[model samples]
Target chain A: MAPKKLGLKQRYAHMTRGLDWETTYQPMDAVFPYDTFEGIKIKDWSAWEDPFRLTMDSYWKFQAEKERKLYAVLDAFAQNNGQTGVSDGRYINVVKLFLTGVSPLEYQAHRGFAFTGRHLRGAGPRIACQMQSLDELRHLQTQIHTISHYNKFFDGIGEFPHMHDRVWYLSVPKSFFDDARAAGPFEFMIAIGFAFEYLLTNLLFVPFMSGAAYNGDMSTVTFGFSAQSDESRHMTLGIEVIKFLLEQHPDNLPIVQKWVDKWFWRGFRVLGLVAMMMDYMLPKKVMSWKEAWEIYFTEAGGSLFQDLERYGLKVPKYADVATEAAEHISHQNWAVFYQYSHAAAFHTWMPDKEHLDWLSEKYPNTFDKYYRPRWEMWAEMEKEGKRFYNPSLPQLCQVCQIPMAYTEPGDPTKIAFRCTEVAGETYHFCSDGCKDIFDAEPEKYIQSWLPVHQIFQGNCGGATVPDVLNWYRMNVGADNMDYVGSPDDRLWSEWHAAKTREAV
Target chain B: MSVTAIVPDYARRIEPRDPVENFHGNMLVYVHWEDHLSFCSAVAFPLPPAIPFGAFVSEVVAPAYAAHPEAASIDWSAVVWMIDGATKVPDMEASLAANGMKHKTLVRFWTPGLSGWKGTAS
Candidate 1:
């Protein structure tokens, strides 16, 4: 027999160490040019510690096992016709949003991490990013495979990838990922890895996974479980990168703080979609958006920042604004969806009496006062055969790309609108947080592709609504309208009726 | 606080994505019906700067807000109109350009008695 196999720690060291070598053909400065431009100082590359220890040898072996488990569940789901098990047809809209809006972001993360892994000089962090890049690719593939079963039985799942690129509301998440990917390597890590993956991923993932479990969707819940282990590794890498940068040099503290502030605000702005799903889309609710925000961001993030206080890193700016917004954003976002239902890929409808009362109970202070009456009025209009869809396109915020629907922080009754003249032209933002972000980097955000502006400029399609609808590839009257009379609704009703008769 | 360049010696002077001239003889203007959160946000319109303000209000803006229950009760002439937050009474017959409404101008109009449905700001 050969020599005894090496211990786990020894094997990890042997595989990771001695991997980075000096460039003989080119200078070290030219090879690792991206790391220094962000003003971060790293005295020693070896000081970078691995948050999780797995070389490519083990990485492939470990991931293949996860793939096997994920696919087995997916096959089982399809064999049993798992689409019929959901709580309601409305719940399919939630999955439709995720497939179109979020899965493409995973693709973006894959590309970002590949760029990051290649550019970073340190072998330790390089290997870390490489593993994460692969994880992201796997996440995107598994998500598509998991949601594809629903595609066979749903109205809105056919055009997910196309919709992600062209849809107006989707620009919110697209722009966010695009901004991060275009930044320097260190900033991408902080923006996506630290701020998004670590800071805010829970708020996004919890509703989808737990909502899937609560609503009896076996395929999606299995996908969530498959991705859970990789997610922990990503969160660990996020913390390690922050600690590595802060510990590397004293000059890095302020730069890291600025990035933390910017991405935290950006992440909060994009989570409004998830907030709406949690509050309105789920037929069987996991929790209210406010409760999820309290648990994920307020309570958990508080102690996290407190831990970082010794490193001279305070909480992100606009934390107070975000806290106040957790209560109102879901309601505001649902109103936007309700009024613009004609333009969306998925169907939209006003909540029923049971749902409205649940929202009122969950959001006692502001729901009845600010939101319930609007729902009641819209519901009444629906009953009277006069469904209200906003005829005009909405004014979008330049930075966030969401419509300017958010109200003032202090006064909920008045809409908050902020604008500034950048280079003698005006740019509008929904809040001071976004305005400040733009003020810092107007050169970057000023080039934002606001979809409404594009549609107005004749870049989308032709002059008519049908022209734009054709460009979006949305099957109007079936894919983009009230759910009550749509094809999906009728099919779901027929299936349940047949099942009821069989039971009798 | 500017964005740090990814590569050294990169150009910094950037152009706005959607500028004034891109709209093809039309200008982008936002109309906010101040207290009506039911419309959800200020509605954006691509209007010719030469369009008369009076006709723009009734032809374009009124149709947008016509579905609201209070739309019928509002006195259009008595509404308080503010252009870009500076209160100004516009000449309804005058063109948008003559009324000082330029690109990205936010025209917020407040109905004297109707804040929102039942004053709930709905």
Candidate 2:
């Protein structure tokens, strides 16, 4: 008989673990320079245990099949003019925000994991990261294809990659991934692989995908399903990498803990956009941002930390502050967008009376108490032929780079302000979490490219708003400002009216 | 504290990206009208340090808040002035530099009775 076909486990073991070799021409340290410099002493490369075994042959085949299925559905979505099927015109702004603010981040993750795949010493994790890197690249491609249909109709999405590099709000997500990509191999793994992928991925992707489902965007939900398989491998690798690093040496715990804490807060700040999207942008609601945070972070991440407690890792620092923030950040972010909508690539509007009542229902304690007045004021101003737009730029935090819009934890009335004097210069922060992050790494934060600072410095093309918008590649009135008289609103309304006429 | 990096030494010294000198003789002064959340956060203006404090108030700070309904009625004498969280009383005729307001200095002012829109404090 032919030699017994190698079983799946044997093949995976041979294909992956059997690939490493001792170097004689160059020392192992020379070959693997990146893994050691991070101060993480890996005692044994062989000791790493992969939670899932996926060889290149199988990874390609599996991913290729998913891509085929995903493309087929996306093709149908485009052919069928699926944009008209969405809940309302306002819903497209959520997609615009994602395409502009988020899709580029997938590409950044791809680059990050590609760098990580080459740098890690262990063959098991190297193969794992390489596969995840390809998965990220594929995810980017699929996300572009998934949302490309919107670009044909939407104003803001036409220059997503351009905007991702330069837009003020897009910088929030861009700088986040840039921070991870610029970190050491070990820190990159912990910051992105563990904290972002395992702990926070559900919180980020679920809102968009579920929002797609609830609002009748089939292609978005379809790609979400396609990417789910790859995400599983990534999540597993995330946990495994954390476990491996922690178990490698006792010294690794503090370093890993700091990365976890830093990335968690950084990721929390970035997710404020998502909070706004779920709360205000989605015409048909899913769970409230507070409710989603409770389920995903409070309940799920609570268990994850409890499990990680065995390795002397407690929950990330300031998790309670982050939890409390979920109640208010959405409103604060929405308000920021509302006043400064003239500068944003997407449209902004005060919610209608019914929508305001929905907000009061969702955020009973805070809505009527703290946030409604601003919305009502803006609405009333619009009625008086004076739609209010903040003429001046707002101050941005040095660490997370969000506008300093967040209020003090206990006091919803005042914007939380924290600052530190580093060297001869002063840096500002939105909260204690960002302050701690800056204090820990003052050298890194002072180099923040705060958009307002850039504009005032005359570096972002010019001194005037029109000049800056030109440099940002913004289409002026077409792309930026309120939704009421926009081309998108007009088209959506025309289509809506035609459908009504046909029904008649 | 320095950046944690594998290559800590670059070819040249690391410089802060937003030093005051980069702004062409102007400093970014952050002004917050306490309890006013409609502007969302403190707004910053690039102004010359030699500009008169009165001009900085009348030209830059006052107009930024002119959109507020109660703006035309506020008592400038009773407005509490704090710079970087410390209460200060500076001469209106003096320069911002003489008033000790430097680059990135946050100037917080409170209008005694006017809290926010309808006292929602937003």
Task: Judge candidate 1 at residue A48 and give its lDDT.
Answer: 90
Scanning candidate 2 chain B in windows of ten residues, the lowest lDDT window is B5-14
lDDT of each: 0.91, 0.89
Per-residue alpha-carbon lDDT of candidate 2 for residues A95-183, written as tens digits (9 for 90 to 100): 88988988888899889998988988788888888888888888888888888889888898888899888888888998899888878
For residues A1-504, write the lDDT of model 1, one tens digit per residue.
Answer: 898998998889888865668899999889887878888889988999898799898899999999999899999989988898889998999999999999999999999999999999999999999999999999999999999889888898899888888889999999999999989999999999999999999999988999999999989999899999999999999999999999989999999999999999999999999999999999999999999999999999999999999899989999999999887999999899989998898988889999999999999999999899999888888889888889899999999999999999978888899998876788899999999989988888888999899998899887777888889899888889888899999989998998999999
Cα lDDT of candidate 2 equals 0.89
TM-score of each: 0.98, 0.98
In candidate 1, how many Å is residue A186 off? Answer: 0.7
- Clashing residue pairs in all predictions, respectively, total 0, 0
Cα TM-score of candidate 2: 0.98
Q: Which runs of model 1 end up more than 4 angstroms from their true locations? A: B7-13
Which pairs, if any, clash in model 1? none
